[model samples]
Target: MIQMIKKLLVIFLALAITSCKTQKATESKDSSQPNVLVFYVDDLRAELGCYGSETAITPNIDKLASDGVMFNKAYTQQAICAPSRMSTLTGLRPETLGVYSIFTPLRKVHKDVVSMPQLFNENGYKTVSIGKVYHHSSDDKKEWSVYYGKEANTYNDPKNIAIIEQLKKEGKNPKGPAFDSADVSDEAYKDGRAAKYAIETLEKLKDDKFLMFVGLSKPHLPFNAPKKYWDLYDKSKFKIPSRKKPEGVYRLSLTKWGELKGYHGIPKEGDLDDDLTRDLIHGYHASVSYIDAQIGKVMQTLEDLDLRKNTMIVFMSDHGYKIGEYGAWCKHSNMEIDTRVPLIISRETNYKKRKAGKTSDALVENVDIFSTLVDVCDLKFAPVSDGKSLIPVIDNPQQKWDEAAYSVYARGKKIMGVTTTDGNWRYTEWRNSNTHEILGAELYEHKNSLLSYENVSGKGNYKSVEQRMKKLLEIKFPSNGEPFLQNDK
Candidate 1:
């Protein structure tokens, strides 16, 4: 009887251990799954006070950065709006996907390519987008489970149409209103409406499990905002960037690239006089502050709805924009200000309780966003993805990652360009599409020349450094006999 009792006890112990293991595995999987909210901004640079900028007042964004892991050297795979957005959504390099310009829609690339929202939706997450998540207004409807706002901005409102007609009569720039703080109304602006709609949806879907995309369109073009926001910044307090032009800097004309001239309007070199420059800076700052206020509203709503503890918030821009940096006022350039954007990720409290107010200098790219979201949500993903999950970095900020960030721009079928950065060295090369002729080359060492005013591409001092960077670029990009040579002409 004692021997029989011993055998039964041993068997019961074994079964208990197996059951415990199964329960632990199930809990681990559940802990990894978290709701995601991507707060995407348009044409925003790393100019916030949190990212070492002293002037711009972005309180809400700064708060988000302080409470999460801030990526100090994050880059967009492309500088343009459409290509950059497409790259982030698809987790593929712009060059590899053959989407190097804004004219082409994402549908043209791969009809069945899984986007971030689509992937999440397939994995049992309710995906929805508010405002301008995608490039065009028309494409947003098809990409999201729900879309808010008009298909496109009413550019031809009777008041604006009259202004355009008058400008045409005078042979002046017929774009829109010049830089004016008090002239615009928030209701007329698309961004304000976007914010309103996003808040409403957040309130309506307070209890639903969702992956919500909140897109903010501000500080992009027209630089339009309420006068109150403009009043927040003193014009005299603004200072222009001190970066100088390189000796052989080749300014690629906008027409050649088939892109917009400037983010707002092409103000001539002398058009933005001292007063105008200060006003422009004020307008830009006001727009940022205005956006920050709107973000605050949304954040407050989330907290009030008791969803903050469960939702994972990610705040980032499609790509950076230049506000008088390098004598430029828009994106589409290969400069650091145009390519490097602000990336902040705020995980829910249940995810291992990361150190609050910590910053990570990890070199990350926009493509990583897709895999990060997937891993955070414990969702299944395809084996072949160009981006790696940022889970390791989020859990341990000091994690090591051996990789470089790359961005590409294609003006035409015959014109293609590429940019790569390894946290310190930045290299840009442009080539003709048909003849494969080298058009332009730019190289800058961030440690030595943070502003990138000094081009050390062919200089004797950096010969070895340039060679090493070139090899890394080739290994990553792998040009197929398309003449990957550098040209400074």
Candidate 2:
């Protein structure tokens, strides 16, 4: 009878051990999954105070960077608004999607391409978008479970028009000024309305596992902001970007200027008086500050609702804008100022247990955002995505990562190409795939020439370097069954 009792006790102990292991595994899985918030901005660059810009006073964004991981060298797949947004959401290159211009519909390219929001929604998350998440006017309602606001704001809406008319009667033009100024307050802009809506959404969706995309449309164009934000900066202290335009560089035609507005050329020497430049700087700084304030509002709401501990926040721009840099006013160039953007990721408490407040120097692209979200959520995805999951680097910043980012732009009927940091050198080459003609080639030794004014492409000393880069380009993107170049004229 005693021997029988001993065997029964052993069996009971074995069952208890197995039960404990199963409970721990279930807890681990629960802790690993986290809610996601993507705060996407338009036409923003790495010009924040945290990124070493002395002029712009972005306290909130700087705080976000301080509290999270700030990427030093993040890039967009393309510099344009629509294509960049498309690449970011789909994890596919613009070339791969055949979406090179704003005129093309994304659905036309691939009706069945899985977007980031769709992926999240399929995995039991309520995915919602507030304001300009995809290209304005592009039919993308199918991607989100709930989409709020118009393509660019409701300016065209009759109600918004009526509101603007009332403000006009009170001696205020909804459109602030000819140039952007930072002297204005956030209350005067549409982004403020968008921010308020996002906060309300967060408050409403408190109990659901959600993927919230808050898109802020500010500091993009018409550079208009309230007068108080402009007052924050001393106009006398503002200085324009130091890079000069290359002589004999091709200029866009009149038709192109009409499409993109006055962003191609520098004001002829002394054309922009000190006051104008300062005002422009003030407007941009104010717009950034305004956006920063809106972001803070959303963050505070999440914290107040006790969602911060389980939510992962990502802040990034669709692409960098020139803001009068390199003698250019807007983005379209393969230059660093136009391509390099700020990217920050704040890990959730569970993910933070393994990777929190850690900065990774690994080169990342906008396309990677799709895979990163999937991996972070512990969801299974198809085997073929153009981007790699950044979870490994998030856990171990010192891990070796070997990949280079690429950006493409179509001018007329031909596409221009750019490849990111090959070691210390950044190379840009433009070729017409149909005509096989090399339009332009620029090679910058980023270690020595960060501003990229000194092009060493023609210099004999960099011949081997240029050759190697050209070879890499050819290997990565073979001629598309056509000639190497075309007549873009």
Candidate 3:
């Protein structure tokens, strides 16, 4: 009986060993696949050192760009937060999803739409969302296996908040010049905490397949940053942009410049004065530096874990911001300043093949991010993407590109503007939503000249250019209620 029991024990142990070996083999195969790490920022424009910004103190981002494909002319589908994010995550345009403003949630429009993270999740990836991946916190709940939450908030010292409140009692909005340079630890801000949590998550998921997305919220509003970063830039050296509302443009194409007005010390009624503009620009630069530090934290963790070779890092902003450009303060226009953003795709292959640090002047859109990742990770399942895959350009920086980018911004049934960029030119038309009447049209030449500073649409010298671009615009963005556009295909 004892000998029989021993033989049975040996058989059981053999079975257990076989099972363990099978599981280990599977894990080893899965681990060989490249991981995706996305660093999505809010309101970051094409102003990094990699993009030729002499003023930005972005070392980590510059390094990432050095080891990645830096897109020189990347634009967003929409300049606003919700619409841009919707188009980016769903791989569809805002018009197709009916997401034009921040009022609507993505699920309310397309509840089961496969998001970028959701696609990865379905493909056996342990998807993670660190912060503000979508504009609304709970819009796409099914996408993430680990949702770190959009725990983004504007935090200020109690003394500042109290002063603002006291001023509010006197009918003053009490914005402290639209900025704060508090002498505090990086942990005092939400972005710092985001980086910390992201680093910890990287350590936890080091052995597994992960799509770890870390969203950094900074340089958005009130331009809050730690004093250490604020000290990086000298306020006296700040230069106000050459203020020029695109000439020959329709009057309706101009906005009332409303974003920064909510601040306590901001002018309640007009564009910022020279002094205020200088200070605001300085604040924005400080905020950029602050966010750069947080990025360095997670990237260092990634490198320390020796995960660089088996990981792909994507760094991008939802849309670009107008930092006093065209005297515009925020991102709500069809101008290049608002539409053009920074996009860097860093693959381990680029580093290994000695083909990294290449810049592509290819006109790319934010929506293309979905397809690009799908192609990179070889994801089995994916939603039909409105944007095209950028892997071709990634493989060869000198490849021929579309030289085109499209964007739109609409305000209710009152007015809507659809913009199209071809090569060095941008053409935008504002139309009355109720009657489909043209309110205004603008055309700006960007090659070897001031970008968007002058509108040549009304000039006879560019009549043919305008006519051709108008035709391209109509073809790219068809009339509403028509077959949805899939031009990238």
Regions more than 4 Å wrong, model 3:
1-31, 164-177, 349-354, 432-437, 479-489
Worst 10 residues of 2 by lDDT: 252-261
Q: What is the C-alpha lDDT of each candidate?
A: 0.72, 0.69, 0.80
Write one digit per residue (lDDT tens) for candidate 2, span 67-149: 67777767888777887888888888776776667666677656788888777665667788887788754555777777875
Summed over model 2, clashes come to 24
Q: How close is candidate 3 to the true structure, as a TM-score?
A: 0.88
TM-score of each: 0.84, 0.81, 0.88
In TM-score terms, candidate 1 sits at 0.84
Candidate 2 segments exceeding 4 Å error: 1-32, 151-185, 247-273, 352-354, 381-383, 448-450, 479-489
> In model 1, which residue pairs have backbone atoms overlapping below 3 Å?
414-433, 415-433
Model 1, stretches more than 4 Å misplaced? 1-32, 149-174, 183-188, 250-271, 381-383, 432-440, 448-450, 479-489
| lDDT (Cα, tens digit) per residue for candidate 3, span 1-489 | 999999999999999987775665455347556898999999998888777787999999998999888888888998889889988888998867866878777887576788887777666688898878888876756678887887645546676777777887887655544777778888787888889899889999888888888888887887888889989988889888877776676665656767688766777775778998988889889889888999898988988998877888899999988878776778887877788889998887534443588998898889998998888777764668899898888888878898578998885546778899875888888876555466778988877532566778878999999998888888766545343322210
Pairs clashing in candidate 3? 174-264, 175-263, 175-264, 175-265
